[model samples]
Target chain A: MSGLKGWREIPIGGLILDAGNAEQYKTGSWRTYRPVWDEGKCIHCLFCWIYCPDSAIIVEEGKMKGIDLEHCKGCGICAEECPPKEKAIEMVLEGEGKGV
Target chain B: MGKIVALTGNDAAGTAMVQIKPDVVAAFPITPQTELMHKFADAVADGEVDTEFVLVESEHSAMSAAVGAAAAGARVMTATSANGFALMWEIVYIAASNRLPIVMTLVNRALSAPINIHCDHSDSMGGRDAGWIQIHSENSQEVYDNLIQGVKIAENKDVLLPVMVTSDGFILSHTLERMEILDEEDVHRFVGEYKPAHTLLDVDHPVTFGPLDLPDYYFEHKRQQVLAMEEARRVILEVGKEFEKLSGRGYGFLEEYQMEGAERAIVALGSTAGTVKQVVDALRERGERVGLIKLRVFRPFPKEELLEALREVKVVAIFDRSHSFGSFGGPLFTEVRSVLYGSDISVEVLNYIYGLGGRNISLEEIEGVFSDLQGVIERGGVKERINYLGVRE
Candidate 1:
């Protein structure tokens, strides 16, 4: 509420006046759980990359690198879609060791 | 300055619509209002206008498409009556809240439970608080004039709220009468082209409309609408004066007829005002002190003008064509009474709900209302505040 706009200061008609302002919103604050990647157990099949709902799974040159915590809502779709045998991606509680 | 021709209210509205040449029109057919769109469709087929006519399956979709077009920076218009108006209730609010200037012709009709399809104020009266400027008409002439003027009022930069120009269903919609129409070039110049400040089609500066307005700012947006409505009061007058220059007939929040030294008056709206005016003239000839207050605009409830108009009258009867159902009196009655409550002038006000489901109120019945006002004056007070006019009971 401190940074929220007043009725007159804000744009008229409840319109979002700027383009590509989604990054400024930082919806990552909504996450309560974080995904942890096990690089050693990784086959890099890229299933987790394909399954990330927020497009938070960072990939480069057709290979999975790691998860981008800036967005990642911790939905765990990547963890569930990862191969059961590999189990390279795991869901962990937020604020746990290296889980932030 | 314009050509005089005989046409029904529907045709007159269609003629005005063709002259305005809105960029888009989305509508569904309904009783009374059906012929209006039919006439516009005929115009579209004949290539008289270059509007994109979207034939939607339902009134809901019609309003939805109108909102989309208006948000996309197109001049949009539509028409509906009664049940059709009821169907479009959701998007109707959306169009106004989004501050889109979509003009709609609301043919006044009875809302159904008994499934009646004739003239009544139930439909538009129910939508009085929907954030749209409501301009009521007394005849085909007003129907034609108000529609053209509605465009300028709705699109006024200071007031970008949607406006509904209403005419009585069947009474005005079906009845043919002589009225003047401005030249196509004159109308085109009067309304000018619609240039919205922000639009969804602006590619360089992309913007989102109708976003989720949470508690943080919902109240503020609503306040903005209130301010716009306040501005509309002045704009309606300015536009009316300018329109009078072109058409020689002026308009305002309400029209006062024969109020000079009047002891009694009747307040009403729509075509019923036409009947009341006849009664006022006949009564005036007989040397009876009576008058008629024809309320043309009901949205911005003209408190100051009404107070001045009713100053000299001792007692007044407000004729409402629809009922408020379980309320103490009809909608107009309540509002008019409230306006006079704290004023320095003390005028006894009575409520009469009449003509529901298109029940006709004859000239004699109107005279009887004035006579009833005489009785209230003689009795020194109103025995019954709420009276049903022409009802069987």
Candidate 2:
């Protein structure tokens, strides 16, 4: 993560950046959505807490918890790790104009 | 009998593609090129042709589908323009590298940043290194005829390289003109069924396709592609001969008009060559020994033929539609100079950039190019900067 800023210098020749035409990015449009914990349907599985790539999902006490949006790029790893059949954690679109 | 009908270049290409009866047709619609696909769809729906038409979401996907189909030993066709071609840039290389005989119609348009959807050589010129056999058509008739012949050249067992038949967008693609349409059986016999040397879907004798080659093998693979392109030079001429026998219309790598005893010649490609020829004829009527060389096949460039054609000429003016910025020369001009390097011809070559982003290249502007060439010939060398016709601040 510390060296991630250097990736901007990489050339993706086909990419076009037009300042006049700003793109609209809404949350939850990704085909593979990331999940956030609600604590209401926690079964103490702790599955999502272990599998997060960024380790953004935090589990307090004996139950599962929500994501820390500060570091999460919404890759959906935690949602995929969650074993609960009730599927307590869900991925939803952010409010209009809200991205990620 | 030779009959004529008015049709856009896109429509002409689309009509030819449908008549060819390819096994799979996949393409993403970009302006100018969109009309080609639209016309193709209409033909498919009307049962004018029997083919599997896959409507892909993007040019990248379109090329991917084409590769997939070609790998399955299907005769495939596709099309794109400008940024769309840029999007498929990676796969365009892949198609040629894997020896897939995919025939594509490129409606030459300008790549965008300031956002232009008009005509230029920028699109195909950008993909010049992609290893596809490239042909530049000067009119709707050439576009139609080349689409049929390109398939033959590409699908030849000895030369299994993808072929791109290009014509200027809007200028050639949308302009209606009377052109001869070949009989279906004649085209079918001329092109024949594409029999690939290898295919992915052959379950009985399975072989790997597009494996990640190490450095040692990668160089050889590139060498093979080069050999295939060189083979294309012979295949194109052979196919041109067969097509002439069937259609009674002669075709060549480069078409020269009134070059006999001429001191100066103007060389160009695409629709602008038509205008240049008109200008040359007008000048010739006035006793100016001027001629025009229209390049029909650009890739596997007819270097030897060009040298032979210009061997007696004193001056050559090359009109380029796309400029290689910062190089201070056009792509075609650079290649021409390199080809003529150290040759005993001693002919002076001048570069002229014209019709960028669909700027109208009138007969008068072409005459101006010739006049400039004549001035250079008289002066024994070019004194002014490389001419940029129709450019404004």
Candidate 3:
């Protein structure tokens, strides 16, 4: 409901002309759990960057920046995709500071 | 402003394409239809017409490319037969829903599995509900004329729907006939320039072509298509009238042949209508009260005209070339019968499935149906509603 519209507010053919406008909405509010990235334990393999459906993982110069919470729905996909035994990422309850 | 020439229906349609000189033509080769695009490609190679010819890998890609060109607001066209049209089935709906006025020359061939490569209405009939303006041609002349007018009818501001001009495969597509070709200038004047209302190539406006619509606006968009179809009826007739001005050949949603003051009639489409007309003439010479209804437009099914024309006819039968298996009868039969529902008119409608896989329908076979109608008229009831014409069983 954020800048996007239902059919009633669209043209006959429903064309989305305003490019990159989906990023305006704060979809992170929908997530009850958010992924906490541990900088110390992080290997920055960028598994989350490759698998984010919404392009929610922030990447800079081919390296993982962090989770882009503005568009992330907090699916904990990054935690699941983390490397074995490293446990570089953990999902924590919303507004509970750091999971570590 | 037209030249008389001998050409097959496929070439005639290709001749029309050459005159219209569309911006892009994306197509794949299939029987009967391949020659139509071959002629178009020849025109492009010989510098007769300036066109970007795309030899796509498959019919699905053919339609996909055609849809893309159309969205970019280019005047585009293509040709395909049975299985090729089936391959294009996915984008067929998308082209219409996107409201692109892309015209296609659909040479009708029987759908495969029993593996047919010959004439039948099943190809176009299969895509009947695909939201495109469908025009049926009776002969080479009609094929050429319909394609030209088809371009206009589809591009009409009110219509803005894709159009499929069909000619029966091999029968009309390969059979050579004498026809008049309109002058390139006259065709250019009539077709004019295509101006899409909303083009994907419009950078300033930046309108998207295909967008996902949830339930909220989907119904409204579909309703708009219904309205566009409603407008198409008027546009088709108007374009036909305009075409008549140049070529002296006119068109209508459905054609009534010797229907006046007649108590009996045979209805059909494509080249079979030509054979039926000859039989009707012979029957009339014997003082028979038989007439013929050659349906030209199947979609936006001419319900009113059909009802009004058949109101007084005591007995009528439709020669359907394609069978709608598991249904009551063939595609044309189901539709023509649907319009005559609840009518007080005592019209005994019969459906005859004929020419499934290029089965030759002789004049004697056509006369037999008329004779059966005569018997039904005299006896007051039909023996079987749906019957096969020439199959050995």
Off by over 4 Å in 1: A1-3, A32-34, A39-55, A59-100
iRMS, all models: 1.1, 16.6, 3.7
Ranking 2 against 3 by lDDT, winner: 3
Using lDDT as the measure, what is the rank order of every candidate, best first? 1, 3, 2
True contacts kept of each: 0.86, 0.00, 0.49
Per-residue alpha-carbon lDDT of candidate 1 for residues B1-393, written as tens digits (9 for 90 to 100): 589999999999999999999999999999989999999999999999999999999999999999999999999999999999999999989999999989999999999989999999999999988899999999999999999999999999999999999989999999999899999999999999999989999998899999887788999999898888999999999999999999999999999999999999999999999999999999999999999999999987899999999999999999999999899899999999999998998999999999999999999999999999999988897888999989896
Note the DockQ of each predicted structure: 0.76, 0.02, 0.36
Q: Write the residue-wise lDDT of candidate 2 on A1-100 in tens digits.
A: 2442232232111111222121222332433444556667767687777877666676678655566665565777666766758676677544422243
Tens-digit per-residue lDDT, B338-378, candidate 2:
88998878898888888888888888877787788788877
Error of 3 at B383 (Å): 0.8
Model 3, residue B167: C-alpha shift (Å):
0.8
* lDDT of candidates 1 onward, in order: 0.92, 0.82, 0.88
Q: Residue B340 of candidate 3: its Cα lDDT?
A: 82
The model with the greatest lDDT is 1
The regions of model 3 sitting more than 4 angstroms off are A1-10, A17-34, A37-70, A73-100
